[model samples]
Target: MSKGLREYAIVDIETTGGSAERSRITEIAIAIHNGVEEIERWESLVNPQQPIPPAIFGLTGISDDMVSDAPLFSEIADTIYALLKDRIFVAHNVNFDYSFIKHQLGEAGWQWQAPKLCTVRLARKIKPGLPSYSLGRLCDVLNIRVQYRHRAGGDVTATVALFNLLLAADSEMVFSQMLRKNGVVQRLPANLSQNTFDNLPVTAGVYYFHDRSGKVIYIGKAINIKKRVAGHFSGHNIQAKRQGFLQEIYDISYERCGTELMALLLECLEINRLWPKYNRALKRVEPRFGLVSYTGMDGYQHLSLTKLLKHQTCIQSFYSLREGAAVFRKMISDLGLDIRFCHFPLEVRLPQTANDLVRRIQDLPDQELYNGKVAAAVELAKADTSSYFIVDRGRDEQEKSCIWIENGKFYGMGYIPSESQSNSWADYKSELQRHHGNEYMMQLIESFLAKSNSRHQVITIDAEQLDEAAILKPVELRMKML
Candidate 1:
């Protein structure tokens, strides 16, 4: 347990193949060391109980016939434990040997875990800019003599020598920091230091990835910052660009949003503001095409899907021309508006000219009905006061999160207690934690309200029960669960 003397066990194992999940170890060697000097050494051949592929035999030079009569790992598991028990396990690519030993030990009735160091990672820091960090290439570059190339005893002895050299060169304790986070966390982006990982918050927020030149290259929103950021680098199917992205990332910055809704809205707004290279949405600056109502010279109200003209009022905006067409088509069908007047391309006999179409539209009863529908839709879409709440999953069974709004302004968001007397704004506000809300927060409220009908629970509070004074005084939250 004592690291004062820098005691470690340099371990190397020749496995049947590349994966610990599918391959079994064929040979093992260990050299216990106290930083600069080797203390004890051990080596053994093991019964892998599996056919050694010809490719592996060619690469490692360990034939199946050699280990045919060798004892199964169960026979020597006790001896392996004695060697690695408290010593920091060290290897060229430590995870390879560490994982093999750890897994094999678990099946041999021993739980094995130890502080680990990878000399590959260490050599990169001590003598960097090497073209490759593979054990063979690295040892050759450093001029460390490898007695035997693929054999366990020879490779582990070379690892021991490399470890001692790294120990002498490590002035910053990089090896110690490498072992700080246990398990597969070592898969983190190599350039991301432990200090950066330690500072990540476990809260809802928007995180930005900045490249070496301090330009934000990517931005993301997450409910748990650490897990989400770690996930970006943890997977096995890492693409070339993904690897480059990790290497290019020089710094990370984050803003904690008090609620997930705020986090989502802020992510959307920041993506639009920055237009980061990785962002796809909200990058276009042009206003979307919309269905607008304008009175023509013939005094007929016409619904046109196009860039709104000066003094024209928009009925609704659509991100794509197709969406606008669909809504316009539905409007024309619902009100029985003539396609010839709306300028829709048709195969049948069409109005000869624009003026003639306007005259036909103005002369029809359909224009009046269309105008009335537009008026009613506009009124229904207006967000005055008392019709908004941002509801998301609760922290626990007895809780629910709600962000309250009134008169199109944010009141605040907080946990809703299961036992409630009234659903008044004041009652909800008393339980709510207030925030310095912004335009994005208001937009989030509106968007959630529009989408809640199908995807979310629409909890309708009795508006008549909430008197004008109730918005201000003693709280009682009553609700009609819808």
Candidate 2:
């Protein structure tokens, strides 16, 4: 190849398995092209030095017996590096091949880096709107015959032909633009389209990544949808799971939220509802400890710290045993109740006078007085569970967003118009979308409310106010100013 002439090395390899870190190449083929025609070609079978899995042998038809006498990658690394040193690397799903070769080369003491062009992405740009872009399906659609289907040599030949077609049909100079160092197109996954990425909105929203079968694989919340999605593809991570995740993403869809808080709430709800494969953070989360009330044989209502139990109501739920114990200790201290009746986790530290208190419990005669104090404490603990609305900025200027907490549980959230004239809570409830709430959702709301600088306003309402005609009068006036 002469200087100043654009050259590409169309390459293909048959590997032992899908992961580059865990698999090795068994066969390789390369076709060198200088803009218009092939200048050189090379093909070889490599002794991977590892047993090929039966599945890979079935796919490529290259068994251990066939590669017994072949050259190891170390023996041919120099030749392979020389041929691809300064040329653009082209392949179907380029990253998969690139990662395998790059990892092997580094192991052989040759660090290599080159520009890559994925024919799958190029075809999508050049041809526009093909139903499927898998090598076999695409060739069948275009009437380009592929022989020796999964073998390296035959796949390289078919790829060369595909590259030629893409070059000829690329009237918009997309190839040249993608070759630029700063182009995002070069970093995107082969199955994802530039148009789909470009269409992501720069606003707070919940985004979904769908696989080829249109099943949601991941769900996330973002303050800026475009920037956050772009971050997922920005790194050069070669882990098998990360690589597989990138390849699985074939489409993206998003739902815009009025505020970051609303986006977070929606993300939690959808993740729980859909149980997407890539969502692991919130799925396993729940309150770990609870403060429950039990009636002992002595006819006294007792307060105790216990592990979260199903089918039993808790006076308060906490994320940690220490937190629950601290609250329980304070309630006992404030109500002047005997500590002997209260059960605590083994890790909890009791006060210095606990032994004396336990001895005195056997002599106590008035159970009614102690029961009254326990009941009063329980009522105080439930006082925080008031029905309220968290009002915040809406998606636009025409409305405001409201998150409803019914009797201290998240009911739902939605946007209400600035000029609404509804008078009762029933009318407001009809405007909101309902969602199932969990302990994690309550924790999020509580944390947000605890923030001293939070801009959202809280509107507390009692059961009696739900039927009043003037319940929303003040809230309506507040919405207009928002």
Candidate 3:
């Protein structure tokens, strides 16, 4: 061994459990070597901020009481990152140690990455046909003594010796093949080539992860496509689901949506269309429930959370039950709607209603505004009688984006030159190229209408004042649509 040999951070970490996503690291130790000799050492008892299970307590002897005063991983993240920054990360089970550190550093707003060297793999190739490769057993076979077996300081100290021996013993090319892969490769599915990975675009857009047969397995949106896609393979804290996802990805593809808003819209559409293997796999935390309104036998329109008939249209749908309840509570306060008439479930009921329950459910200021303006936008689109306008900010400032709905169907989204911003509706439509829009676009627009309260929003146009209709204002660029 000499000074010219590459530096390695021979590392070990003990954790509350296996998965980096769900579990926490309790201890870490690093023994840095210049591929020649151990240069320095660092160790920490990390406060995992989680309850250590009784079994883990017995196994590592790292108790909650012992770690009560220790600094959290966040506190020591900078020091750990500096040590492992440029050197290859060496570990007995490199994936486990590397991934735990990577995820912990990520939580602390740092990126952890390095080339990997698994001493376990190295030992098997160097020694050949060992009876047992476990660190304790292997050290015993080779006459190397290790203290403090389950603790990071002891295990990493043991690994440093094991690593040097294997490097000295590598008479064949096994170690060179192992060195061919960088840390990122360890998480990439075997079927994807480094060349394909290098070719990913760095623009803001939507990306698709595909299986070997070319079927989409996952869909994602990112402001920087390359960085985000690179992150998908950043760690190997391989949970079963994540491992399966990696095994399935054969290639990657993407669509460059010039605007983040467009990218967001497209991501929602693609997820709804493909419903890929990995996307939306977790149960939704926010409620996807809604309340619908119908006219009952008493001639009063009733609102209820239960599923209703086809003709019973929804007043509003919310992302969470709590959001729906808030809106209902506001309705009772403003519209003087009765608590019983609110028709919400028991969990949503307020303990005490406003003493004066005035049932003025009709002709409210909001109701009048929606009826006059918002309803006009829908009716204009629905009647398909005349050209309607939905103007939006373009991909960039030099142009503007517009949506035209003819006959209550998505006509297309097209661009207008900023120079011609004041062009009439007919002129704008004349320059519009025929483009594709889908069911998602319709819903996207519907949602927009529910949320908006702009004055210049054009539901229908005056035949003579066409030029004014085309200039999309910055204020009108927002969507309050439902």
Candidate 4:
């Protein structure tokens, strides 16, 4: 080994499952290289102390029977640690292998941390424009051969060869640049470019991560676009979905917003529109159950819990059937309404007094009076449905952002010049961009308004104001009124 030459521990491991936290390593291989030639080669089959799933056994051809007599990872922990210590951990999709070893080593009472080099990322950087970067495809492209496909020993051999090729082709010293301490380029997705990340603004915005074919895979909103994007790649989460997501990120695009509220709104809209694969949180935020009213054949008004139906209005919405039922039962109890007139789903366990109330249908109030009470409760629930506008800072100092809520729903939002004299809500509506609103968007606005320190100002607009062209006071005056 020559002085000043970087050392690498080329590694590969077969695991019982995809998650490092849940899975155990079944086999491991390490090839010690002094940035020139292999100094040592080591391999082992380990008793993972768990049954190997059939799928994994079939893939690696290493069944539980084979590892039954093998040594546990604890027995070889010291040797593995010594081999990897002070060497750059190199592997195909390196984080997956590194996470497993690092976790299992910790379980064995050894804390190990090392710089890592991913051959897949190196090939994309040094040998650009390859159709695929998977180990098998790369071998086929580079004329490298392997005796066993999924086994650690065989995969590590091919990875070493690929690393050598990348080293020879890396005339731009991408390796050195990536290895620098706290380099953002090293943490970025293998397919994403440094320039794309470098160009990200520190302002509030929504960002989109697209795959190689330009299909959006994920969408997120951040106060600082670059900082938040970096967070996605910061942790070594060896979960299969996260690993796969990082690999698919090939490009990034962003839309800057004046406020975090605007970024959040845009994020929700885009996630719903694009239906990106990695966006699961916002999509599931919509309420699933609603409280509805209908007239019975007996000339009585009835309230029921029903699944949210498109084009049908609800007195109130809830995320779960139980939640909607709870509120419905409270309303009925408070109004002293007949339990028989309210429809409860089969899943709901009625209160102990429900049977007693059902027998009191003969004692029910007059039809007109009972219906009037129901109508009053409906009106109370609808009180928060009034139209309003939220005014805040815009993308730049010269403008201000306006969010219009019509009849208690998010109508749209847009920026207006700071000096614009238009004060009519009707004029503001024409200037803003229209968007379909959902329960989640409404929740965001409601939560924002509830914050006592919020800088935004709210202006209430009545239906009569829309008809009469009523003028809205300036935002500063509105703040004073609040």
| Candidate that scores best on TM-score | 2
Q: Candidate 1 lDDT, tens digit per residue, 378-428?
A: 454343456446555565557666766655567666678655566356667
Q: Please provide TM-scores, in order, for all candidate models, with all chains considered together.
A: 0.48, 0.83, 0.48, 0.80
Candidate 3 vs candidate 4, TM-score winner: 4
Clashing pairs in 2: none
Q: Model 4: clashing residue pairs?
A: none
By lDDT, rank the candidates, best first. Answer: 2, 4, 3, 1
RMSD of each: 13.8, 4.4, 11.7, 5.5
The lDDT for every candidate, in the order shown, is 0.69, 0.85, 0.70, 0.84
Over 4 Å off in model 3, which ranges?
1-4, 7-114, 117-202, 272-275, 280-287, 293-301, 307-319, 322-340, 347-354, 358-398, 404-411, 420-482
lDDT of 3 at 23: 83
**Which run of 10 residues does model 1 get worst, by summed lDDT?**
344-353
Error of 4 at 436 (Å): 1.1
Return the lDDT, model 2, position 141.
87
Predicted structure 3: lDDT: 0.70
Order the candidate numbers by TM-score, best to worst: 2, 4, 1, 3
**Pairwise lDDT winner, candidates 2 and 3:** 2
For model 2, residues 1-482, the per-residue Cα lDDT tens digits are: 22226798999999988788888999999999988878899999999999999998889999999999999999999989998898898899998888888888888999898889999988988887888999998899888889999999999999998888888788888787778732577778899878899899999999999999999999999999999998998766767888899999999999998888899899999998899998987888878898888899979888888998765678888887866777788887777777777888887888555777645555875788878888888889877657778888888989889999988789999999877777666777789999888878887787667652547777777766655635556654323111
Error of 3 at 459 (Å): 7.7
lDDT, candidate 4, residue 13?
A: 98
Model 4 C-alpha lDDT per residue in residues 1-482, reported as the tens digit of each score? 23227789999999998888888999999999888778899999999999999999999999999999999999999999999999988888777888899989998999998887778778887888889989999999989887799999999999888888887777888788778733566667767777788899999999999998999989999999989999999976878778778878989999999989999899999999999998988777867888888899888888888888765678888777866787788888887767777777898987556877645657777999989877887777667658778888899999989999988789999998888887765776798999997888887776667563547777776676667664544442323223
- Ten consecutive residues with minimal summed lDDT in candidate 3? 473-482
